[model samples]
Structure formats: C-alpha cells, structure tokens
Target: MTRFPLLAGAALLALATSASATSFVATTDTLGGLTANASESTSDISSSFDDDKIVRAARDDAASFVASNGAIRGAQLEAALRHIRQQAPQVQADDQQLARAILAL
Candidate 1:
C-alpha cells in the first residue's frame, strides 16, 4: 500500500539524520584537537620572538628620527643608520630584515 512506502521513507530519513549527527560529533572532536595544537604552537612562537631590548631601542630611535625630520635622505639616512648601529652594534647597513622593520616604523 502507499501508506507502507510512506512509513518506510520516514524511517529511512530518521536513520540518516541520526547517522549524520554522529559523524558531525566525530568531526567536531577532530577539529578541537587541531585547534588546541595550533594554539600551543602559536604561543611558543610568540614567546620566542617577543621583542629584545636592543631591537626595541633601535626601533624607538628610528621612530624618533622619522618624527623629527619627516623623511630620511642623504646624510640623514646615514645618521639614522649610524644611530641604530650605535644602539645595536650587530645590525649591518645591508641587513634586509632590520631595514624592513625600521622602514615599517
């Protein structure tokens, strides 16, 4: 009878719904583990690179130079570089990262 088919379809739909809910719970647990792992690694990296005193001083000096003159050029460029080197002697003129960091300021 048509009623029998309707009842079978309703039962199949309920089973499918319950199966999907179980799969979703499993997927959510997996995602939670991944999120925890990522958070731990992110904290480790942040603590490792948390600014050094020398780098901080150099950035401050660069900021001051920019504030005072509006733009660095010619002898001013040399002076800014010299000031940074004086504060942190390890920084070379051609050190790309330092240059980029200072310029970003």
Candidate 2:
C-alpha cells in the first residue's frame, strides 16, 4: 500500500515536470497575403487589441459617443472627447483642447 502511494507521487511529479517543459508553438501560413481563416483573423485582432488597450478603448468610447448622440455634431464632439479622456487619462490638457474643438464643430 505504501509503495503504491510512492509510485503515484512519482508519476504525478513526472507529469508535472513534463508539462512544464513543453513549449507552445505558433505558426502562420499566409495565402495571398491574408490569413487563412476567421480564427486566425480573430486571434490576430485580439493580440493587437491586447497590445494597444488604451487606443482600442478610446476608439470604442468614440464610437459609443457617436451612437448615443443621434449623429448630432455637438454630441459627436462630446463623445469623442469623453472617449479620449477615458482611454488616455495622462493627456488631460490634450483632452480638454480636443473637447473644445469637437464642441465648436
């Protein structure tokens, strides 16, 4: 009974070590300069968004603003400004200036 437990523990340790040693591989085959399938496209887009979270967030906010404002010029500007601020809080002065410009238009 004790030997059975020892063997099980050894097997578990080996499994863990092997799993840790395994490497992940990523490859792509481009056909006419485009990705092969929708999965690849989604993966690529997701990776890009992950890298540029702030930019993506800003763009999303801008789109939301446009959507909520009923295509009105003033609402469009406010939305854009709000989005920029939300996405890039480090640029307060720039956000204010952009908000003014958008409101004016």
How does each model score on lDDT?
0.54, 0.46
* Candidate 2 per-residue lDDT over residues 1-105, each given as its tens digit: 899999999999999877666532122234433434533443433343344434343444344444565333344445545555565454424433342323322
What is candidate 2's TM-score against the reference?
0.24
| Model 2 root mean square deviation, Cα atoms | 14.9
Model 1 stretches with alpha carbons more than 4 Å out? 48-105
Error of 1 at 3 (Å): 2.7
lDDT of prediction 2: 0.46
Candidate 1 lDDT, tens digit per residue, 1-105? 999999999999999999999999999999998767655543433343346443444555555455656353344345545555565554333433333455454
What are the clashing pairs of model 1? none
Q: Which candidate is the best by lDDT?
A: 1
Worst 10 residues of 2 by lDDT: 23-32
